[model samples]
Target: MTTSASDKQKSTEPVTKTENSETVTKYSRLPETKNSPVRRNNRRPQKSFQGSNVSGPIFQYFMTGDDAQVATTPTKKRPSLGSLSDVGSSFDGELPEQSPRKMTICEAIDEKFSPVNYSACSFTSIGLSPVKHDKDGTVRVPWTLVLEDRNIAFAGDSDTLCKYCGNVRDLDLSHNDLQSWSEIVKILKEMPHLEQLNLGQNKRLSLSYDFSTLVQSQYTNGEQSKAEKPLSNDSPSTESCPGSEVNDPQTEHDVQKKPPVSLPLTLPSAEGLRGHRDDFVHTSLKTLVLINTGAPMDTIAQMLPRLPSLEELHLSLNGYKQIENSVMKIVEPHSRVKTLYFTDNHFSDWRDFAKLGHIFPKTKNLYLACNQLPCIDISFEGVFTSLESLHLGGNKLDSWDCLDRLNELQSLKSLRIHDIPFYANYDPDPTIRRSLCIARLKNVSHLNGSAVSPDNRIDAERFLIRHYLDHHPKPQRYFELVDKYGQLEKLGEVDLSPIEQICLQLHCSEMEICKEIQVKPSITVLQLKTCVSEIIGIGLKDFNLFYKDAMMEEAFGPVGCFSELKLMSIQLSTAGLCDQSELHARTISRHHNAQRQPSR
Candidate 1:
């Protein structure tokens, strides 16, 4: 394209305008040069201008980025959970053992509750208040910490933990990866004021494992060494120690000639348990939850004495089918524990469960729900002397005899026994189920969480009486109730069909009329009057009706329009007439006159 000299000069100069009363400068296209286009290097030199944003500054360096000596900004470093140093775990030249996938409780606590994030931590026990300065100007920390489901394997240094959460009272470390009971004891020993501790779902923390280790050490040093030195036929096989002894019964002379047989393993002495118990003392812990922690009766035996002030213990879903005799002998009678929860367990035998009564003699509340208990042992009496509440729901009990045996517990006032086969066979209605249970448990004032009043008891006992009245044999309690409140009469059969019908006898003293009518009891008073007028040929306004019930009174005064006629004898009388004789005479005279006149 050809350009004129004047047009070229105008294009090179800047164009200006006024916008919204502000001076604005516009740029025209620059003329091309031979070596390179006209460009401004922002890195070398800069020019400042003051004008409106109708045309913004267009710099050349912004299009093609600068490489050397670029203006740099420093980055801030974030704090992290350091290795085993914080927890006092020292390996001189090697790394302390830990799972790469899981974090220690100390590591998790440090990461979640660092000083920088103190304002964010929810301090639950102290009204969920965030971190704040106290009157003394020291920062107040949380009293409750929840580190559940954090894959925490180790408990960290007790001293270090106390420095951070020293005031923690209710700590929930449940659903973690803690496996060592020693690690738990470390945490408990540090927190003297800890009232509630939840360590549920840490399935590997078993005291029995430690006991087994002790037994193995003793066997290796004593019996194993002796067997290896002797190498004789008398040496016992670990697989079937009892079987080998039974198979090779020794006579008197043979017994004297050979050494006495002994098993390869031996139960830990009470002295050894005492030493272990001394390691787990926590006087202020009132509630300890170790559900599904693989802890058995031995673990419980080890813990009960240490936590002398603990009133509630939950050890559910630990595969506790039976209580070992050795463990029972080891556990001292703990009267401090008032409540115990052993639900969702493997307790099938009543005798096995009865051992708990001896272990915790004064436990008032006991929950054994969701077990395979076939029946309660009637013979196990005088054991649960202090038990007031018993929960036996979701069991395999199918007989009333099992419930009758519960009468042995004189102190049992609350009983929860639903979802059992015994009650399920009667009916699905909760009322009937509760009635049956109440009837069976005579002393229970609370059944399935509902308070059973005296009237309810009487009704339940009467229901039980009628329930078993047809059978050839009756329960012992039935005869007892009969003696207490005479023999209850059989209840009448009720009509259960839709729209029930009743037979009512209608009597009229003024007209000397008597008739029986079948009608629905649900009809209103006006509808009832219409029915009586149509059925008995009586006018609606001629007589006033009165009802007499055999159960209540001889006769109720003239029934009103709003009065009900449900299952009652109806009597009709002349309206506004006091004397019955005059009314009858008038009716008879009218009837005679009608007969004499004949049909018109």
Candidate 2:
């Protein structure tokens, strides 16, 4: 059944070797060409004992159209995936027809993008570049891809079979079923130009416990390949059947003498990642998005140092309620990270902000929305001087004291501080609150998602001045406000709590019992009445602000004529009311006359 060199030259296609060409056996033959004459011989083709191999057009293509006459090679089927059972078993009967030719990796991706939508895959925003087509019906190498929410698994190296390993710039595989971090590493190594990688929502991704299993698997594979490799063509076997040299004493001795191979006692970080044969020094990625990946603290600790070039890191929606000081210190070396997204986390203390400052020292834009912070102290305020934009919306901030700290951030130009407890409880006018915030954080250009215009700042400054004068009752404050903001054009007053709680009674037709009022001390009597009037929608003329509930002297003496009132028992009553409600204040206004209206 052996064919000679003469028979090989006549039967096989001409082979072309280049400087970089890989070594292939010249005895390999190609399928018959169209113009060749048919042979009349009854002899069957020799079936070699060699195992099946998945060759290229995908992996084993002979693309060279060389002028030099050499020889050509061949291909075969592939072995089973995962486990190898019945590997060398004979299939004498006719093989089953190749089942509808399943798609290659490139074909699957290309047809995924096909307008026909015949591919059975679900994914979004797959950006592709058509480079060239192969005879295997696969597309050419694309430079970028977005495989978010794609219910696909990682393609083996021999699969999809991209020719270019270094062209990719950005890849987003968010919300996908990429179950393993090792699989992610395999994919990233193929993309050297990658600068941004969003692996968010890959809920199953986690660092491997150890690489011992992988190392052992590779070790077993290397030995098996060596044993199965064919002997030299010049040194033909003396025995009739193949693999007959197993009985030889020399072969048996060689097997016994080989040392028991094992992995290193411990592997270095990231080097322990799969594909350990190649050196692990990839810093090309500049942006990494890891939302809801649920990476462990130890895993994060291992990865941060390995990724020194990262400029942006997004870790939102991960439910990171707390990160230890030790864990934060692990990422301190990666100071190049400029923008960080920590939204929807459960940061409960100001110490968390200090840790964030250390971990991302150069971060210019920070998103801290939807955390559990109750308060912020001035001591830690200096840590975030590098921040340009700070989003603290959806937090439990309880005082203007935190807003006052915004001024400490030298580069802060945009601030988001909505849904905060302090302002929601006391500040009735949003416009005045916004203006006050703008006036306080003078350098901020935007507040609460709106741009702070020049007019807005001027108006806000007036509100600030008036709030200062009314709340402090000090003439020095009035002089200071006038000197700084030169006669505030108009003031919008709001009864907001300056530091602590203030009590005031309200007589509303809708409610039964009156409760203590909550407003800033700086708020004047007129402002308090107006805030109550606007919130309760009562007629301003119908309500009276009285001291001691006796209705004797109007609170703040009908406004600006007196300073802010120090009411031992502040009473706000409806004029000409019935005697059903018993209070310390007496309603002396006549039935025909209205109540005393407070003025600013």
Candidate 3:
């Protein structure tokens, strides 16, 4: 009872219908590749499931034996289109068929594809089913093959069942075409040992699942529900289907029963991540790498305080315009953080880093490279005591004097001067004079006796000269007075004619003469006259030593008739002038002594 190919074609032919007198209408069978249009139109039946308000479930259905059969209905009209025989002539011959391979999941797992060595396990693809070891006769799942505490799953085409391995500390499901959030949530809820999860580059997944509502509905008691409402009704309510009724409390409770506990983890994606705060549970996150994630700085600031154990954070290449001071203040209390990287963020000011010094005193490595920092005058001594290395390269610095205060950083070992403007301007020639280099070398430890060329010596000398010669006129006047009036003077018993003549010849001002003639003890009348003569360049050799002694007696007798003149003469002579041979030779001649007391 075998049928020919022509007979099978005729059985699937189109039915025809006849209109009033001459017109005919016909319907032809669609090609084998095209789906039946009527079945496609009727496929989408409106059936909602539990938790449909929060998330939609994927639907799959299978038809039974009777429902799979196709039925043909006869019509009264004749077909206007070409017959089946005409379509059959287009093909030259029968096409060859392909034999399907009988590769079961169990058989694929049994064949030893490769030895699962932990050191060599960089598997790009993992198929479903367990790997069977021939030697030990043991079956091991793909997840169990991970030796590291953190497990990353990026199986692109390998839809391996990610279950049963509870030891995985971290999981990365980036770049996989995971279209269902419910499936990912189910896997995450089941993997109890999972800690950190990465779902970056999964453009199809959404992170907007209401985990708070899910938690409250499942875990809260009646008292807890009364104390804290199960969910915030104030949150904007989404519209339900027009005539659909809300689920009863029992049904909602049953549907919200807690699945097996999994690790608190992260699920990130490019799309829908801006508004997806519910995906981040920061309680267990020790470190987070959010490079190129496009998360706003304000959002990051708001979220960072909640992460209790967050110790290291990397926000490189996140296109942040500026890191707010308040953001630093919020993270300042998180004492556990030891490292923070803000490299390539285009920051121009370094005043914000002063707060960082106060916040993370124990921080060892801070990367602030590739920014437009023009001036940095931070005191890195007490703050960076524990700092090992600091990177401030690729900035617009003209001098390294700003780092002079960092001499107290004893723990600082390696300072990278690569690409810094000051280092870039460094010349290897020993003759080049750089004051900043000299100062830095002098202050740094273990660098003594280093010779430095005096670069700023000219400026320093000019400054000193300006300081010393501020006033000059009074000093010059004193010098003139000493030169003119500093000479021996003479006086007589009832006459001071010689003293007056000496004052007139020198043109001495009263103050000048008083200052110069105030340095001698008492003198006799003859000695006073001799002193006055010496001042006028006259005869100082006329009086003998005995004659001078007699004049002193006469001047002091009977209320001292010439006592003032004697005192003035003695003061001028003893002050310095008449006592020295240089002054006497300049004033009076030695030959005058020959006239007074004959030649020896």
Candidate 4:
């Protein structure tokens, strides 16, 4: 195979998911020509197997290269397929001469597939087969391939994708037509060792004239329509809402068969998830993705506690315009969720984040990119304290104050800020923008998609310090930031005032002790008073840097930073009377440790 310069890739762009296919490393366009028989006939996996909970397994993602080349990099190798050689004829490494291909069937998959290489193994259909206890896949393979619209027959709980891949950790059932939540649970009962589940693009429920939905829809739209009042739950049919039963016999029978839901939200409880017949609850599953499923946040929220082992929950592109009451009940300050994603949801307000203080206590990664978020307020910082990697790209965030707020999130180490409105407000200089963002997020290891170099960080911080010092010099944020990150290397060195050593003799009868302390030229009387309080074992309100000299008050008063005239006189006195420079700890003997607010 001849490889061109363009075909030989150089850069190491890590794993990324596009809107369409779920590639392992990054999105690569498949062979677009019609003659490329390897191109997928059906849609690609509807969602990314978002690998936030990275403990159990890494699926050998089979990606298609530009030359109809199937790129398969398997992390783990399963047993060899030598036993079922009699079932199928031995073949050389080449694709079958069929359009959709003849190798896709589940029975045909008995012992042929291996993780090492599957480039020529093109298949069109996967069948429903009961799991076999026979050794080395006599009737069943460990992993099964099933796609939604790929002419695969998935007949309820008996779907072999669940039964065969039961003990395996990660499972992707994206683009499947698993319609009802009940049907999904039936499938879930089989996968005992599933560590991750991706159930995107499922058949959405067609609900209509429902009062709870009407009220919620009205609330989301900022106005109620014809239905202002809620109907009583007691006055109900069996179809999820009152008087909403379908006229068809199958629909009516199905409705009548189901119990009436009294609650306004369509969320299922733990009890509902596992009825009396459930064999086991899957505590091993860690990550759950429900992208584009159209399930309400409340419904998803209700599903949280039931799945106690979940570490990451992704619900992207769901039509949630607002995080409302029912949603807040389960999400805020509650959950074992370590990484949560609400991408493309258009959730804007930051004030509501206050309720999420304890949510995801151990959460390290968070992705909320591509929303209509305007700004991240100061109060919002505490909510994201536990995050390590945060994605806030493509939001409407439009201010520098948000940078200050972001800095307050102590544990944050990675940040993505692409297409933010703040960048739009500034001149289109990417270097300046990148430098400022790096400086603002001092602890960030990675910015956008690249690593933050130490030299780059130093330079960025230097630029940031200069930028701030030139604009707003003496702000407390400056002092605090400088104190933390230090003066930005040699390029931006902070200068300090000249200092002198002062020997002060305490007037205690025990010993003639003199304590040497460093004093700056512009040191304050108030600061001296506080120092005296610490040294003399006197309360702050009682201790005083008292000087009987009448003119000292005028000298130390708030005209400048300190009493300049008194300091000059002290300097002169120090030069002439160089006799160990003993200065007594002056006090009102009648009223020892005499200090006050100086009469305001």
Candidate 5:
């Protein structure tokens, strides 16, 4: 079911290749072209070779010549061992000597010297036994064996004929040492019905031929007869023209045609993906999957345009550094491709993704995880209008500006931002906290206006917590103080031991938590209510001033009010226990005396 040159050209109808050969032509097709004749006719059939009844020795013959002069050896069909006679003549008819009655299909297939040569026959479909082994002792069931348009699968490497195979629509040759694309091409050339080919995990083969040059050369040669014209009156005689044996000028001029470019048949690299750029142009290959093979980007870019009906591409783990911009440029011209997956690569920038909207405008799912993207800047709104699922987890992004831009993508159904930085800086001052809260609230409100549900707030909170945990020092002491005071009783009820230990070790409080409480006056009140019982000797006025000094020190240290208050509190707390009661009354007097005492 291979496509003839004429059929291929006709399939790309409305696309004309000029005879000059100076420019390469481009063509586009509607999505409905999947049902085109070129596709249907070029599909390869399945193969199968199985039977229940063990028929007696049967002979099959294939005739090719019109006169029938040649007669190759007829294929021998042996019956199952169970159906064979127990007493078979091994030496002479009188002896009735018998070895094992007959060989099973497995035994027949395993015999290296068996006269069975199934490869010579072209069947449409074949089914093989799974227990069959090849000559090399490798399990050799046709992962996908095609005889003409038929596809056949053997359980094992059995010498079975595909009896009822039709045109092969798909072929799978996944695990074999079929090292050459030429071998594959030869096999495909035999099965003209082949439409889909799976050659995955075959490290040695490649689809690298420049098929366009071959097609063009053939086309130019075919057009030679039509391109011929009469020579001018002043032209040299026919005999003077190169390669002309006659004196007629007309025939001499006709012989002078420029030779077409001869591209090498073999690919440059051992992978053999080089000439595929041309193959797609000249053939009817609608789908191609090359996963894990280190095919160069330049080769992929050049080949993309030729596959007009290509709808899906899976190119994962290819060690790509950057998404080839040329890939975007090439695919931009194609409206048929719908899905593309390039996960676990080294794509570091989002700008490369910006091209997706322009190229695969109708792409629905895009997966880009485990990449080296520090930040993404996708400002183009409505770029992913048709995109439904986007997986961008495991990236390093400290901001949400990219997500903000994606708010306009109304079609996005699932968005994954796993393992991303979620929190920013926080200040303890009430005013600053209030400002920061208001700003974040505004951003959240903007996001809420988009298609994202209210539940996203929980995700946002988790993100913020993760970010704070990664950046801020331990605030365990704060939690411990709250626990001792029975403040934030609900929070304290749950074990605060872990946080307390962490805080005690670091001796630092997380400013973010305080800022969160300060922004919401209700939270401040809750804190005060929880800690009231713990403030036995601490006066409300002193606690208030102490909090104010702490806030001031956090905001503006040394020259602030908290600096002087901290010194006074330290001296008061350090005074003798017997004089502690008098210290409060003398505290103000001492301050006055100290001011009056000296400037030093």
Candidate 6:
């Protein structure tokens, strides 16, 4: 085959053409198209691509002669950009930009809490079961939002939260990916009326940042609601109240110059505060549950001042070994919390509890259940002066001295000390253990949630008095009750010998027939009824069995078939009686003679 003069002058590449098809035999150029004019060879091009980056075919040619093409190296075609329908205008094919898919807190809330996801009385979300509520039930409003295990990491914007969850009162953000206090504050500062917050089981959470500085930064950026500016001289004035700020000229200038000083004064309303206090304080949050969040004492101390209005603080399951001494120095700002739950922790020393009472001086109710407390210390008696209720269940306390020390809590009204070694090993019976607690604590009106009535108090005190009658070094409460009840006599020894036989009297006033029967102690009421059936000549179901007490004069009927008849005090009646299950038959002494029928 022959090539054109232009192709020969352009390149030395081999060209071969066959009669059947103009094709290269081996390593030769084929017939190029008539429109192809660009030269092609094995050599790579050195020209740089310098255009608007619009992608198309790599090689273009305009041929003028026979349809013969040169052998060119194969180049990988660039991957096509996927559909960009969502990308408005800025995204071009050049930079290969990719937007991250991380979910923000507001998007999570919206996706999980939108109206379309709600049914008649329930709402559903991803990776969670549906939350249900009733119109007229305890949950009258959707004021609580639980976003536990939602994998939320970033706080996007407060404006979105304000639009959706503006009135939210309780928020549960447990088991999420919130890494810092700033993210939590970003979310909390939007809810002006939030009351309870549960951040349980979150990993890598820290609340130890300077909250005052955070609040100041948020306010400086105008991200937080601007504090109400002081009334200008030109503004109309209302009636002045007592203790209102006096407009002194120097103080006015100072307030105008120092914007930080005026921030607290401007937050007079709940909406104004937005949990943004200058001194690391939140006014509306009353309960904070931080169970198993791995927060330490330093973190707690740092957060306490921020939660000034927090009344119930649940710090359970955090593996706290002891209260840090640093807590002692930081107690002044956090002492007003009234209820604290430190249950399921690792604290064993009562000195730590003493430190708790010192840290929270006004704590009224304390729950330290499921801990490893071994004993109560003397220091504990005086520290919890205002404590009204205490729960020490599931502890290691084994000594009676702990009980005595607990009695020193003058304001203590209710006490729970179950599952302790002292009771589990010594008493074993819950009834006796409860009586012992009621008898020991003088001011305690409730023991393990049951009220201590006057009769219960008397019986418990007498039992306690007899309990320690012969024991050496009796409890101090024993002496106190002994003085009140006047040295009660020791209980007589109980005769526990089983009876071999019992004598029962049977009388039917309608038939004027009276008889005396002797039966073995092992006979049940059903066997006694069968024996009576043979005597009275009546079927077992025709007449009901009743036994009337001779001393108490109270009649009981419909006795249980399996009850032993040996201990029953028997008197006869002919008429049918009502159910008297409450009245039980008591054993009569052998000396009491039955009124037998005279000889007919």
The candidate that achieves the highest lDDT relative to the unseen native structure: 1
Task: Give one digit per residue, the lDDT tens place, for model 6 in 32-147.
Answer: 54665434554332221111111111112211222223333223332342344322113445744432223455445534532322222111122212322233211112578887
Worst 10 residues of 5 by lDDT: 499-508
Q: List the residue pairs that clash in candidate 1.
A: none
lDDT of 2 by residue, 135-225 (tens): 5443344567665544433433422333333466777777655545555555565565778888888776544323323334444423522
Which residues of candidate 3, in runs, are more than 4 Å off?
1-166, 173-251, 254-285, 326-332, 381-385, 408-410, 428-600
Each prediction's number of clashing residue pairs: 0, 13, 11, 1, 54, 15
Cα displacement (angstroms), candidate 5, residue 205, comes to: 6.0
For each candidate in the order shown, give its overall lDDT on alpha carbons.
Answer: 0.62, 0.55, 0.40, 0.52, 0.41, 0.60
Instruction: Put down candidate 3 lDDT per residue, 1-600, tens digits, no spaces.
Output: 997989767755645456676333333443343443332222212121111222211111111222222322221231242433421122237532321121212212222232221122111222322332223222234543322211111121111222223334565544333333333444443344454555444433322232333333333332222212212121111221111233468855765574544443332322323334333333455655554444455445444444546677676666666667656644434456667777777777666666566665676767777777775566555665566666666767666555554455667544444466766566654334233333343233221223323444333223223322443432232233335434223323495433321211121122232112221333444554555455544464432211122344476863332122223334443432332111111233457755777556
lDDT for model 2, please: 0.55
- Summarize candidate 1's per-residue lDDT along 1-600 as a digit string, tens digits: 999999888975656677899555555555666753444432322222221121111111111123222221111233353567443233568774542334555456534443222232111111222433333322334578888877676655444444444567888989876646656766886677899999998865754434333334332322322211222232223211111122234544454465444456644444444455333457788999988887867766866666788999998888788898988777788889999999999888888767888888899999999999996654757788989999999999988888788888999999988788987677788788778778889899998899999999888988988877786677777888778878667988898865455565666666666777665655555565667677556676544454443323335433321222332333222121111211111122455656777576
RMSD of 6: 21.9
Q: On residues 1-600, what C-alpha lDDT tens digit does candidate 5 reach at each position?
A: 786878766754434355676333333331234443222232322212222222112212222223211113334453442322332213434543223332222233233222243434223222223334333322333333422211111111111221111234465554333323333433443333445665555444333433333334333433422211222222222222112222456745664563555554432221243354423231344445555555556556555554555677666666777756555543434566677777778878777676656766777777777777775565657576677777777767665455545555777666665555542333445344332222233223322123433555444433334333444453333333334433331212465432111010101122111211112122233333234313323333323222323355567874562222233233222321111121010012345656777665
Full ranking by lDDT? 1, 6, 2, 4, 5, 3
Q: Using Cα atoms with residue i matched to residue i, what is each candidate's TM-score against the true structure?
A: 0.57, 0.51, 0.36, 0.47, 0.38, 0.55
Please tell me which predicted candidate would have the highest TM-score against the true structure.
Answer: 1
Predicted structure 1: clash tally: 0
How far residue 229's Cα lies from its native spot in candidate 2, in Å, is: 28
Give a tens-digit lDDT track for model 4, residues 356-449: 4455666778778898878775465456667788888898888877777877778888889888887998869999988888877767899998
Error of 5 at 503 (Å): 30
Which is the winner by TM-score between candidate 2 and candidate 4? 2
Query: Which residue runs of candidate 6 sit more than 4 Å off their true CA positions?
Result: 1-102, 115-142, 206-280, 333-335, 493-498, 502-600
- Cα distance off (Å), candidate 4, residue 179: 1.6
